[model samples]
Target: MTAHFVQVANAERLAADVMADVMTPPPPVDYLRWAEDNIIFTERESPLPGPYNRDLFFYFDEILRALSPDDPCRIVSVHKSAQLGGTVLANIFCGGSLAMDPGDFLYVHPTENNAQRWSKMKLVPMLKGTPALTKLFPMKARDGSDSVLYKERIDGKGAIQISGANSPASLSQVTMKRQVQDDLSKWEMNNAGDPETQADSRSQAHEFAKILKVSTPLVDPGCRITKSFEDGSQEKLYLPCPQCGHMQTLEWENFLANLDEDKPENSHFVCVDTECGGVIEEHHRPAMFKAAKLLELNGVEVWRSENPKAKRFHRSFHLWSAYSLLQSFERIARAWLNARGDPASEQTFFNDVVGRAYKTLGEAPPWEGLRDRAAKSDHPKGRIPVGFPIVTVGVDCQADRVEFQVVAWGRDYRRAVVDYGVFPGHISTKECWAFLDGLVRQEYANGYGRKIGMDLLAIDGNAWTEDVWGWAKRHLSSKVIMVRGVPSESAPLLARVKKERSRSGKLLSYSKRFYNFATSVLKMGLYRNLVKDDPLSRGHIALPRGLDDEYFRQLTAESRRAKRLKTGFIAYEWVKDPAQANEGLDTHLQAEAAAIKFGVRSMPDSMWDRYEADRERPPAEAQYEIEDLMAPGLPYVPPAPAAAPALPTKKLTKAKVRRGKWMNADG
Candidate 1:
């Protein structure tokens, strides 16, 4: 009886001791370091599964540390290119929040679809694959405790609700201690003007609420994320040159190695230091990463600084592809080389690849800028200039007449308006289209002697859609296409291509292909081309001398005006001046559309060289016989018949021409 009483007392005491120990908080540890030790890369979904490699991601150590609970700063903005270990930062942040400071976390994406995709591709895989995380956030779809859009920690007062920027109500309803907004730049506009006000409203309850904003950045400074990036401390990554040991931010201009043109892949990069221009080979990246450091720029450098004030509490960083271990200098150089001349592509290179906003395309050209640069051509209106290879035709339909132009394209996208005129017939009549066909079939002899014919034709099918559609069916070929304008301001110069259907609802036999080209983007390209200081730039137009002043007036008729969006963002559009006609501008834009569809931009130099070599030689004179000229009444002379060579008696060394058939020949 005495032993049993003692055992029960000891068991109770031991249980009490265990409960006390469970209440004790875990010791402080670096959140990033802890993640590196525990987080598994997940082999089923990721090739790199295991403990995180701190050396590979050493640069992020300071940024992640500042996001830790120990840090005083409550907000952080990571403006960067995609797939540069930004997700790893997100993972470690969530893991730390769950383990130490247990509370709600809201992961926001650009849209509902984006949120769902990230949960499936990133969140779920991350939890199920990592043993450490799997224990904390186990999957249980049936119980409603764990789901794709929401999750509750199995052992803590922690939960995560994933939502999109579009759902502002959801963002405000659920208060979270930490908000992870991935791709913040892509968030859709809200009725309230800014989605940030609604989303940030949720975090008002917590004093130390963490707001993490990450994005690749969009064009407009009015974009929510771009504005945020400017407001925060602008931090940049700098690396010591492996060769010269001079610290510098690696920019696209510093290292230019691929001017050789033919073998672009062999492009190289070097240090920017003029005194020590040293080759920075691929192998030197590891050392560069080791020496990499982040420098926070002053307020003056931030985009659109008002009073040189940067948010003291928020940490913002901007890193380019140059510092990315996965990206190479050669790869970035090649992308720049291809994107240099064209605004859309060049902007893409700046925004997506380098994670920097592109410079504004600039203002419209002065009306006389291109007019002064016009090439003096001796060839007449119907003739193609020397060195011009391919020709494209642009046709515009109107109520009274059809305006058409023949534009010749050469290497470097050099354009020549060889011929243009008004067809004196209404679009509703058959004569207008017939005149178009006649112009298409007409060939012009170029200065190089090459018989130049239109390689591609694009006709605007804006008004009189039915008439244009019917006419396109009869005239459409591999080289001919109909273009309909899509007023989508954000779309590229070429938006979507599809096949046109006849009245019977079946695809047409000829010219079935139709393109929904964005007029706004094309106009932007046109304006940018005209504004080029160098005549050699792509999209530059060389007007022939014969064109009258009225043609010039029509060509420069359109001027760009900024159109304000509902969200207060500025969008520029080409508005026609009421005083001048824009038919000439439309023709040139359509001609460019035709050239783009024909793949002239992608044509190889060797193919262009072959085109350059061919000359338009005149057709040879017809061969004629003397009998054709001689009259049939003329009498033949006997001496002429006797002049025929005598038959050889001996075996001839060489065969002699004989009129007799093989069977009748001498045996």
Candidate 2:
């Protein structure tokens, strides 16, 4: 009986020891130290798998420290490029927070699919690889505390919830102490409003709550991350020159001077300091990064704010691929070289490599400036300019009236607006149609004293499709055609002609074909051309002296805007105020489309010379027939047969046959 009592006493002592150990609080440690000692990188997630190394990403040290619970900063914003370890730093902070300072953590992505992808490819691997995180989330089938999107600590101190910015429900219904917003710039607004604000509201209940926002910027005016970064203490990494000790940010312009196109690997950075223009090689990047300091625009260290008593809650940092060890100078140089002359590719380089927003070229020029420039132009209205070989017309049909713009095309896509006017009658009436037909049939004199007929006339069929189509069918002998505008930005200037089909899916022989043109693409092109100051430059638009201020306002009525769609993707569209009229802009776009369809964009110099020679021909001599000037690549249209004598019965050589056809090419 005494032995059994001793056994029970020993068992009770052992149980007390286990209970005491479980109840004891963990030792105090900052987020940086905790992350370095506890975090592990799996092979699938990291290039340098195994243990987390602070030295490899020394630039992230200050950022990581700012995320600590002890730090006064409640918000950390990282405006960074891809492959710069920004996302990895975010992951480290989250892991450290869950293991060291237990709290209800929330992770938000741009979309549900993005959340699922990051959870499966990133979160699970990270948690399973780290011993500290695995202890909290065993990830077993029977473990009620673990899941693909949620994980709970064994001690029941806190849990993590993963969600997407697109789902309003996921961003609400729970209060979180820590939140991470990945790709915040790409987040879209839900039915409830801005996803960023919705997700941030969840953390309002906790006084010491923490939020980390990270993303590469998009366009400047609409980027959410850029706004956040500007609101906080804007800090940029400034590396000291090895020779002069002058601190400077690594700018792309300075690097371009030393970039060897033949051998990009030999590229180096030149110090921007005027007195100390030292050449810094790529090998010196490591030491420079280690000794780098974060400085504001005024050259003051960010950490050493002037007012220490002021409670600054947000800390923002900017990083680019040039500062990252994973990216080489050679790769950046190659990408820049390849992206030249292409706006889309260059935007990607700016966002993903330079970590800056791309200033889009789609912006409209000031209407006042355009009006002033037009007033000073030498060209006159209602007459074609010298050296112009083609004339095209664009018509905008409205319920009350119809607007038309006549444009002359010269070599290299140069344009001169010859005339523009409006007919007051309704488009559905025959009077308006008669006025447009008269304009199309009228011949205008050029500087060389030769009259030229309109090469192509494109009329918008969107408002009165049936009326426009009926008019177009009647003017089939002329160059009149029907066109409609499409919303796609990537569409070509002129899409393929779509033919009408019968109910049996058979092609209708007598059906009229209409073309779809990309309105955004043409409008962007026109706006860019309107700002060109040099008349000799290709794509330069020359305005006649008679254009009024109202014309200029109508021309610049619309402006390009960045809009987020329901799918969380950004789309650029031309938007105008409801009170504004955009008939001038619409007509110009249609005229440009008509010119493109006439093959003016792809005309060769030899063909243009032939047209010029024909214009300079004497009036007595038979001028080259207008019908024979069919645009290259267009279906051959047989011209009217000219009155000619019968050919000789004898066999003709190639030269004689050609001469004979010159008299009647259509025969």
- Clashing residue pairs in all predictions, respectively, total 4, 0
Tell me which residue pairs clash in candidate 2. Answer: none
Query: What CA RMSD would you report for each candidate?
Result: 16.4, 13.3
| lDDT per model vs. reference | 0.68, 0.75
Q: TM-score of each candidate?
A: 0.70, 0.60
lDDT of 1 by residue, 134-235 (tens): 788867646887877888998758888999888766676688899888887666665555566667778889998888888876555434556776778766
Could you say which candidate leads in TM-score? Answer: 1
Candidate 1 yields a Cα-based lDDT of: 0.68
Write candidate 2's Cα lDDT for 178-283 as tens digits.
Answer: 9899988778667877788888889999898889999988766667788778777777767789888787778777887888989988888988888988888877
- Give, for candidate 2, the lowest lDDT window spanning 10 residues: 643-652
